[model samples]
Target: AGVDDGSRLRLRGEGEAGPPGSQPGDLYIFIRVAPDEIFQRQEYDVYCRLNLSFSQAALGADIEVPLLNNESKIIKVKAATQSGEMMRITGAGIPHVRGNGRGDQIIQMMVETPKKLNKKQKAIFQELAEIEGNPIKETLKGFFQKLKR
Candidate 1:
């Protein structure tokens, strides 16, 4: 039977056999779930952190997330989804040993800003900033121009 961490897996009649015809004592195994790189576990629930690019988060996307079963789940990321936001996929977590259903898959989002921008990329972003009518965009433009001086 599947067991959770710190829980004992019982082996009935597999222990020291009692006197002939008598029931044997039980054997127990301590279950320790090793740490994994992709998933964090709590009981049967599973959690993961996913990174999205600035445009992906802002424009929305369907991301393919790896699963424990070697499968992938497509998560629908809503437009304007912010960093650190969470999306829960029902019945996408670890399967319960005794229960009929599984836990939910919790996705923690991280919006990634580009660390380097090419000239064309910078211009595109500047245009986007202007389109957004953000005052900081103008300030940023002046800052970049000042760097050229």
Candidate 2:
């Protein structure tokens, strides 16, 4: 009989062959990695949201924030001089690939006021309101005049 070289050849006269002349071939396998939620695989950068307190936003403070490895870290954030300011914490984002550099952490400043003010607080605010003297209207008028020119 003509048998190909790649095919298995059985010899009836083979000695010490598992009692009845049996054979086994080698096996091969491949594996793949699954996506992870905690770790984001990216080339460039990663972003996340960070909340701040009223006092924290008013006066710059160092506060602890949560990270991936269940560890807390204190990141110093500069206080917002004006309302609606954003603070960026550099190189505090997700891990990067081997060749590329790491990402950054963006912390947005949100001024949160108290729901109910105490009597002393209200009185202080009233005094401040009286002292400010409608600066917003004057500022807007100046801005519009500058825009016209």
Candidate 3:
């Protein structure tokens, strides 16, 4: 029940029979743990990714994350959360291989931008762009300055 990948078990005299007067060889078995579809393990730590809509990321929301079992937990994503951010849940990962405590679960946040917009959506975005001015122009200016240096 406590076994993990790479664990070996040796069975004495469980191999093929040898000569009449000699002892049989031992049988060694290696353990191989199959990969789970959702979670990825590193040592005792587990990791997964969560996708967030642009509005959800900008306005904050409570999202559900899956556990090792068939359960889930809700985590709060703070407002203005950026893409590629990481959220860690302490003691929510896999149990230690041979210890009393468990590890942590790390979730990577991915913010998705819409690919297609309706007429009203496009109008709203254009208004926002107007209010925000031209960020691309400022970014390009910074890039050119860096290149000149």
Best by lDDT: 3
Clashing residue pairs in candidate 3 (N, C-alpha, C atoms within 3 angstroms): none
Assess candidate 1 and give its TM-score to the true structure. 0.73
- What lDDT does candidate 2 reach at residue 40? 35
lDDT of 3 by residue, 76-135 (tens): 999999999999999888787665998899999999999999999877777777788843
TM-score for all predictions?
Answer: 0.73, 0.48, 0.77
Q: How should the candidates be ordered by TM-score, best one leading?
A: 3, 1, 2
Runs off by more than 4 Å, candidate 1: 12-27, 130-149
**Candidate 2 lDDT, tens digit per residue, 66-135?**
5544776787767663445655556666555454555665544456677898999777666776788743
Q: 1-149, model 1: which lDDT tens digit per residue?
A: 23566877789878888998899999888888787898888777788999999999999999999877889988899999999999988888888888698887799999999999999988888888778886333477788999999
For residue 45, give model 1's deviation from the true position in Å.
1.6
**TM-score of model number 2:** 0.48
Q: Count backbone clashes in candidate 2.
A: 0
Model 2 spans with C-alpha error above 4 angstroms: 1-44, 53-55, 98-100, 134-149
